[model samples]
Target chain A: MSHPVACCYLKTGRALMSTQRPDARQLPSRRIADDLRQAIETGELLPGARLPSERELAGQYGTARNTAREAIRLLTDEGLVIPEHGRGVFVRRESPLIRLGNDRYSHKYRESGLSPFLLECAKQGKTGRFEVLSIDQAQPSAEVARHLRLPMSEPSVLVRENVFYADQDPVHRVTTYIPWTIAEGTGLLNPEVGHPYGIHGILEERGHTMTRLRESVSARMPKPEETRYLHLPPAVPVLDVLHLSIDQDHNPYELTRFVMRADLTGLLYDTPIE
Target chain B: MSHPVACCYLKTGRALMSTQRPDARQLPSRRIADDLRQAIETGELLPGARLPSERELAGQYGTARNTAREAIRLLTDEGLVIPEHGRGVFVRRESPLIRLGNDRYSHKYRESGLSPFLLECAKQGKTGRFEVLSIDQAQPSAEVARHLRLPMSEPSVLVRENVFYADQDPVHRVTTYIPWTIAEGTGLLNPEVGHPYGIHGILEERGHTMTRLRESVSARMPKPEETRYLHLPPAVPVLDVLHLSIDQDHNPYELTRFVMRADLTGLLYDTPIE
Candidate 1:
């Protein structure tokens, strides 16, 4: 029942909450999560701070132990705290990932010699790297074939898959698909290992200039295999984005199924209105 | 344990699955959720389809009763099913909520007399409506203040709050913040009951002439209040977005916080890459 690490955090957080408006009529689970989330947001409980155990929280809040556990589960789902199997929960470490926005396509970034992902990391004062999980020539899903405008008789596509790491965390898993004709003709069917700017550079070099993109985003609980592959924790959802990379001629030469840990990533879109 | 409604759905879903590739290696809970979700997607279980009760699912899947309940919870989180207390779960009725994209500021939509939200619903073959909750002059939170570029001494902001419904389901709860200067000068502070295009119309007429929009999108578990207001089910996450609306002179005129039910909404972003 003892909480050795959370004792100091509790004192500071309570003092901080007193100055704010009352929580008003939230349930025990919500109040607890809100209190801790506030503590995390306000810097009363720093990242990596160990949270009070369920038993200690139950005793402190005078609520049933299960309610306290639910509070932690809520925070876990919010990506505010992470539980380490036998070790207790700790405030989740948050490292911002640069949202690869429309600017990544700019000639400046492409000419800078750093991949857009790496440029983003540098801007954010971090380092980025990607490890290739695979590169293969294979028949694609029907959705992919359709997006690439490949004929039903088309046989294969060059699929390049990798896990992008930001701040040493595996943040994104991407699978890029290109039709066989372009893949074979552009010499992208077999990539030279670890090219800068990833596939965008390859496409640019081959005269397939990417000018527009259409992206659809959805959230879903990851399947078990995805959980393992993405290192996602329980209650963490995946942000699945389907991107159709269009060229100057309006051809969708690249179709990417991008998956990111919802708990950790934020996407930004900025564009001129009219 | 008897399921009067789901029996025919199961047979047809199984037949459909046979023609499609089988789901390999998914656990019992996942396979159960996947089957029902497939049924929902393929029209075997149409919108408002009554899902089998937990007991019925348990009997059908040969899983522990709790496992079947977990399966239902998964679908609920995906926003594919809605669980009504004492009434069992139903396939969630989805009406598209048009993602407020960069094009909303385009003269075409602005001049079309339909607000972007209305235009989106119309495009998807449905009607959209919004009910005003409250309008007041108040100090916004720090985040909103920053986005509005309000000076510290600025007294108040005109806050317009409303809930948007698509096909009678509450889909978005938004709070729009406008700086005091604009609020006072334009007579928008205590204006009419509704503006057709919402805040954008007011801004356009007042010469704000929005030229750019920056949006950040993330997902989180809805608060208890949000659950009540939006009628969100347990485990369903809400897609939370923050918008910074900018004028030609690079001044931020509107700061809007938008919350939408994740299960029923798909956000599409189409933009020029470079």
Candidate 2:
């Protein structure tokens, strides 16, 4: 059984402040997280056991609903708890053990232009599935306008927002946009039904390929909707990665914006020597 | 005049509630940062502008001392501001733009049994200098203990600490611990002087080398000291990457904890065919 990780005093020689183990009364939410964490560790709360509703748990722990919820979120992020939509949260049977390495990505891009990461997902039975949220052939926002190099007057375009799940759990959520005229001629015009090929794979097969790709990564606190969809805790960080793929002619083909559960994926890189 | 970054809107669409647009009532510190950003875009600030001192800038902007300092820190993480200890912050006149995608780490490892990432640093240029922080030849921590297969009582000896900058700005901060005792034997034992070889390079020379590596990536809010060392803004995120390297016998050689500036580095990966 695991307990709250007890790290030895690292700054042992520092004399500025006397160090003492934080007693139970120090922090309300942290104390709740620890109390519940102890229960989970000691088998008082078995794996897959349905935890009490947030309000009940709050009352039991003698804390506010928000504090109890926050504690649950911490355990959730640590892979100890699982929250089910429209259902009570449960203890996760096991933590997701990820193997972080670069072997899969290099093989895909070298042998086939298809992203190896995507290929590995398929092979590992972690095939990507999308639940289309909303689709619109609307005017591109200023940001999209610049990325796609469309004139401000380029009118309405196609925008699709969806959540991508692996093994029935939401892992990423994306909102992608493209010029309507360009997309209208393509199969992506149908938002209700997703094509067998992801948009990138489809684009490559159609010879409207992305010869160059640029990406930017950042992180921020998740908002309410994102937190709900991701089932993430307030302290759990998300990876905000923006991908811009351009054609051989340097014409931007697509601009994809997405957030991924950082714990689920490791960024890998192998650059060509100059 | 530069506009407030659009990122805040993507985060919270209710921009009206959060953002205060550039107005006459704007604080001088904010105004200073905005003005400098605009001047950079317009080539007025140029590169390497010896920025006004914190006190001077506070006087110029009619703002408090702390606010002016924070404004500069924000720009520093944006890759526009460069600060020097004892010297005033400057507009980064010329700093090597380190490209993350140009070198293939795997191939270098396969050929030389050592990575260029370590070698290149040891063989420094005018701008490159590696400062070794604290080095402890002591027992591994709990995380390292599990990886090195050391019993709770049996000490799996190691060293852990940071790598500082040549220009006194932190390039990357890392704490690496290895199980092998050769690390202590290899004349690489002092924090006051730089090491002749880096971790990987030294391991290769010692004849126990890693053929592959695995990295786990995540991001988090930087601790106060980390933010100051990395010269990061409180809002800016830092990449927390952990690398585990195994030797030919599949024995773990090193466990490295690294924190990189999310904005400064791009991580790329190419996987091999299965």
Candidate 3:
């Protein structure tokens, strides 16, 4: 259930070398990358293991040090390695991936008063922390307005923006927009909200029980602000997951927008069919 | 229902500018990009609308033409704009987003012999097409091995690889691996298996009905092979959706790996809560 990232990475092992030789024009760095990549896939080079220095790689392969460095760069772009300025290159650690399922939003978790992030982190044997970047009364974006079924000019939202971190690594930055009507007279407008249960519990307690959730998932290059805050490498994209929470009557309530680091995360969803 | 991509893009309207003034040190291009992004978000610059030429932008902003070009480049990188070689830059159009829920695999769809992809595309009002890339019995990848619960030592799979297109645009490339045991007794080995319904229909008719599906989603830069086959621009990310199909008895049967264009596709999953 955990380590989804590792499982996905292992899928690349499908690239088995064929008996046929490579094209004569293939770059040396590309060939080097393929062999190193194969080693990583087969577990010959485990995560957290350091690769040989450029000089060593060049000496062994009889190629330019820059060419060896380029091979390492290729692996880094593939999310298989990370280069620390002066410390050399090391295999990237595959974090315990995010496994989001139907159960996380259960009344059980709500009753026990634990934020989903906190519960998920604890379940994965990691400490979770969230910082409230800001909380304010603001104009709802057009999508939020649509979800809340309000004309854009007339609606406002209680925007609670926060970033969730597992230990020291910032994993996701979320902005949850709650309509003024649904948020009014509830603790949701407060920056602190419902301590243990979070806003969902508060919403449920207020008679607006969530009956359904709609989520749309996409990925894109991160914005400059996100690049700085998320510490994402140049090549890794960001996952944009938007969630819409609806009450028992299917009335929409909160819309949370998540900008997550793609390299460090994988979303797991399961559904039963007839 | 048809274009999930367009709906997701409409979501960018979530950014409502703040009243506070920004600090003066922001880069000129960054500032230019933000304002243009806001215009796009608010619908002032609609999709497919051509952006001002670099010369016009520079003249209007009293900045270098190169600075203006950089700003447009920023938008293109964000997927907000597309630059067609000599045609200049224009707002990117939204394609039909893939809103895949649990229903596409229901008994009704299977009985009606509707392939999930066709049903999905039709519901969105988009024409769908599939091109078979290759069909062969081959060694299953480790992920497939794990999904089918077979030892790495033995077991092969009937691999069916295909590319899907929406209208004229290549949207997704899918490779499905079925264990030899499950595939041997069915028509799934054929390049064209249970047409109109695909493999699931044949499996259902054979009483190996799929009862559940588990999906994992991740994103990264596309491989050179994928870039060439999928016709993906260098900046766009690819969504890697790996799915496992399980029968009523909870035994895994099929493993399908999809490499979809992230910019043109979004997966919509909805579920009910107690």
The runs of at least 3 residues in candidate 3 whose Cα sits more than 4 Å from the true structure, single-residue gaps closed, are A1-77, A80-83, A86-91, A111-116, A151-154, A194-197, B1-96, B111-116, B119-126, B151-154, B194-197
Q: lDDT tens digits, residues B1-274, model 2?
A: 3333322223333333235564432544556677766677678877877777887666665556665786786466455677888888877654332323223334444456433434443444424445677777787768777766666665656676776453455656878777646576764465543332245556778776666565666765565467678886333456776766767677667777777665444344322223
Q: Which structure is stronger by lDDT: 2 or 3?
A: 3
Worst 10 residues of 2 chain A by lDDT: A1-10
TM-scores, each model vs. reference: 0.77, 0.50, 0.75
Worst 10 residues of 3 chain B by lDDT: B1-10
In the range B1-274, model 3's lDDT, one tens digit per residue, is 0111111112443323344365442555666777788888889989988777877776666566777788887787666788877788888886657655656667777556666777778888888888888888998767689888976666888888888887787889998887887778677767766433467877767667787788889988887678878998646899999988888889888888889998778787777774
Give the worst 10-residue stretch by lDDT in candidate 2 chain B.
B1-10
Best by DockQ: 3
> Considering lDDT, where higher is better, how would the candidates rank from best to worst?
3, 1, 2
lDDT of 1 by residue, B28-118 (tens): 6777887887788789998998998898888787666776888887777556688888898998775444565556557787556677777
- CA lDDT of each prediction against the hidden true structure: 0.74, 0.60, 0.75
lDDT of 1 by residue, A1-274 (tens): 2232332224334433345456443566677787888888899889999998888888777666877888897787656788886789999775554666656556777566777778677788877888778788899988888888888887589898889888767878988888877777665655564543556777778779888888887766675567788887766767778888889998888888888877667678887775
State fnat for each of the candidate structures.
0.65, 0.20, 0.86
Output the TM-score of candidate 1: 0.77
